[model samples]
Target: MNRREWGLTTLAGLTGLALPRATSAQSAGTGRGYRYVHLDVFTDRRLAGNQLLVFVQPAGLDTDAMQALTRESNYSECTFVWPPEQPGTDHRVRIFGRTAEMPFAGHPTIGTAFALAHAGVLKPAMSKTVFGLGVGPTHIDLEWKGRQLAFAWMTQLKPTFGKTVDDAGGLAAAIGLEKDAVIRPAQEVHTGSTFLIVPLATRKAVDAAVLDRAKVDAVLTAAGVQRRGLYVFSTERGQDDATAYSRLLGSGGIEDPATGSAAGPAGSYAVKHGLVPSDRAASIIFLQGVLVRRPSRIHVNVASAGSEIASVKVGGTSVVVGEGSMSV
Candidate 1:
């Protein structure tokens, strides 16, 4: 489909969903308020990707208020954009999960860039923007199809390969998969965020896997990587355009539809382990969130310099679904 046709189809699909409405009760009182934009990240169509809420003008909102709003929305993550405190950055974005603030996250970073552009804070002529995240300065490159933002890519930190877990049976059981389904030993990888990358045998194995939180935590804790979550993936692709199928199961068995932070490391791991050709630049597409009905397609590009990974970039498209305001 053409760009216009694709945009219209996405709009039509999301129109029926409830748009954000101002909280009249809170607006009536002395409570402060902030405007927010709703977005679906990592998908061209609406309502099918990971959801994000972005507060475009969150001047008065404190940390407590941001955390409260994140819990209220119950989305995987939310972002509050602030004036840049550092040099050469466009804005400073604070990302918050359902319960606490995060150092950095994938969907929120790209989704917030789209949100800023949609809100007119970013001009169409501007092709790039940098966000000062908790992890430090994060650079985002923008691609525009005419005036519309077609895609955004975030350059993540260099990959740090950590401990390798030798307990294949324990790792498999943690995610309710058979030991035979594991194709290789699990290893910890960090690119801003940390995830234990588990190589599974097939797409069916990835989809069939379920998170056993207690067991998974036990395995991670034993490896001295208790803070990291499980990122199970199979290089065997069920979709023609994808290189892999994957899932991110965090503590409490919560599954993220799309994980941008993990995608960088995932691509790095793929190139290092020969899952993808390492002779040249590698571009990998990961299909995730299908099991939860919210499908997300994440793109990763890895540049190799000799035996080392030169750079890692994670990117995707996002749709601005809805908008509204809430009291802070």
Candidate 2:
């Protein structure tokens, strides 16, 4: 569908979903209203992938206000876009979770780009848009299908591999899995963010695993690695389109539907450990959020120069599910 038609259809769908509408009285009392777009990232369909709320014009919202709005939205994360602070960037995006601000996050970056493009902030004919994130300038390559945004790819930072945890029993216990379920050693991997990449034996094992936060903290402490979320996956996909079935359980016991930041590190770890073929540039697709019923498809392309990873690109499609305004 064309962009206009697609937007109209999305609004119709949002009306059916019964999203809250701001009344005139509310707007008047608040003085100004911030327009925000709702999007589902890492999926083509609405209400399925990772949910991200992007405030297109957040001129008056401070950092605390952003965090409050993020918590109010009750999504995994939200983004506030501002005029470009860096010379070469198109915009500056601040990512906030329910409680704190994050330097970088995968779905928020991709979803914000799609939201801006859909709202006509970014030109439809432009092939790329850059956002100055907490981690620095992040380049997003855009692809268009007719008048619609087809997909967006973000170039993440270089992968950094850290200490490995060989205590299989402790790792399994930390995630409520059997020792045999862990097929390989768990290791710390970082791209934009740090995640402990755990290789499971089967998709069932990956799904069955649950995080015990106290135990997880203990395991990371003993391994001499900084505390981070766990990105567990299984490569034994029988007929799925994705290369790996994965899940992310954060240290706070909250699970992510889709994790773009972790996907880069996961792809890098897979290539380095021979979990997937590294003979050439490898495109690894991770199927996550299945257990939570918000299935997400995250694509990671890993290019290796001999034994070292040369580049990592995470890309996926997003749908504009809804739009609303918040009085601030």
Candidate 3:
């Protein structure tokens, strides 16, 4: 094991003492340590997409421990599952990024539902699993191919348009691109969390782009864009002609392989700016994280009723890569 894995294994040993027994082993009796499943989301193929770790039954790990565990996993995001606190809910999920907890995130919620169903904790016959997230009850629809879970689609919260950065020159400098490279004004939109939506001139600009944290912070601060996630997309797309090539840059200089949360707001931004037709049901294929070698494909669907957006849904396939037990 590498240093992080070794540290996680050691923490797993202690997690058994901190949390109550949910189950022992894979079945029967009570258990201490939490079982975690690792999966690659937004891609059907293994080793692509974004890496996510889901703690199947985190009974006792508090905020600090969850944050620490997320840092140790070093993945884009980690999730913890608990029994639902409200009626008509399948589970309660808490999402954590590398350094902090998030109210809502796209891949973690989807991946956690897949992990739960794969573990037999969630019923295969159930078509939808409602996770009580910090934002609210977010529903994920499941597809079954025989007895196995084949696909998952999440209905995100409504889009809330935030600030708009009209200073295209300043915004271009923030993310390592030319003034002519920015196609649209930088927009801040939120579904559950906020993201600065940037439209680039071409796929090459999206690919060659590098993040200057100082400039990025300066631009965001100047525009009053509180959310630090930067999402840039190009119409030229990747791997497919219909796809929109995209990348999501976190505050720590980490680029997300596939960003579901940002996808929702991006769809709204596109429709709002007439980048994509919103006359009817529309779908945008997002190809992201290729420069980092973890190519991910995110399918973003938007339904519009006239000028207003009816709903936004994000869906993708995932495959289990690994599984282990984590102590508190």
Candidate 4:
């Protein structure tokens, strides 16, 4: 089968005996094994949140291998540790995908924090505990969600809103929609990694999207937003906590059921476009992954200091679903 075939098919196409494997090159007894912990993020309800794979204390795996592991897992993202944050070492949290190391990704951040908290690694704080990642330090507030460890709040990195790529028409047309359905001048928004915010006219528009990889690749190549350009849309009609609907589409041979990093930036975009009332930088709820069927709820706060703009923070709840020991 061709890669394009895989791209065209839904996620149900890839479930089979071909996913997990144990390479014969290493012994399970090596100082190279990894511990797995499952994290359910963004929603208090179990199985209704984002899933994560936490590699506790992966101190010996190299870069290329970690990248390959994420590709093999095929999850949105995975995390690792180089020195294993012992009794006194600074935790060097590294994130990876099929492609490269991402500076930051939301669910992984939440999951990592949850694991650290459960492991008794981080000192508990009343509000939140700041975690140091490869990108930088981040804070996550831990709470007991009915005998389960969950995140009450998470403070994201500073946002960066850049040029609105002048290719909305081309993109909408390529995605099998009327040119006008694509929101004008797709803006680059980022709290960790930048994503091109392309607003669709309605929920129906979002549901029927047909973004061929080739078309998006061509447009992004033309506009020079390579390795980025995640498309997000919402069913939000009037904008309220329970009504805020959204989804994230990866144009680069991927799909994110829950995108906290991208959604944080989208909250910033919402404030910039005046979609949400600026009430002294409020925290709001965003519902994502409904169309894709994962059903994630990400919380975001957009702070506006008298029109001067401020920080945007996103966080979620997580539950451990599975765990395993792997021979690296």
Number of the predicted model whose lDDT against the real structure is largest: 2
Across 1-328, the per-residue lDDT of candidate 2 in tens digits comes to: 9999999999999888966788998656874778999999999998789999999989988888888889999998999999999999989999999889999999999999899989988766899989999999999999998878889999999899999999988899888988899888899998989989999999999989988888988988888978878899999976778899999975455678999999999999988998998753367899999988899999998987778888899999999998999875
Segments of candidate 1 deviating more than 4 angstroms? 1-30, 221-224, 250-253, 279-281
RMSD of each: 5.8, 4.5, 8.2, 10.3
Cα-based lDDT for every prediction: 0.88, 0.90, 0.83, 0.71
Q: Candidate 2, residue 70: CA error in Å?
A: 1.2
Question: Per-residue CA lDDT of candidate 4, range 1-328, in tens?
Answer: 7987777575556664386566665445465567867677777666767777778777667888788778777777888755434343346678886689888888888778777666666545434655566567766666765545556566776678886668888988767778877765668887777887877777767766776778877887788776465555753564445435666765654456788878888788877876667772476677777766678878888887776567777877776677776664
Point out the higher-scoring one by lDDT: 1 or 4: 1
lDDT of 1 at 193: 90
Clashes of each: 0, 0, 5, 2
For candidate 4, give the lDDT of residue 96.
Answer: 85
Best-to-worst lDDT order: 2, 1, 3, 4
The CA lDDT at 300 in model 2 is 93
* Model 1 accuracy (lDDT, Cα): 0.88
Top candidate, metric TM-score: 2
Query: Residue 128 of candidate 2: its Cα lDDT?
Result: 95
Comparing 1 with 3 on TM-score, the higher-scoring candidate is: 1
Worst-scoring 10-residue span by lDDT in model 4? 81-90
RMSD of 1: 5.8
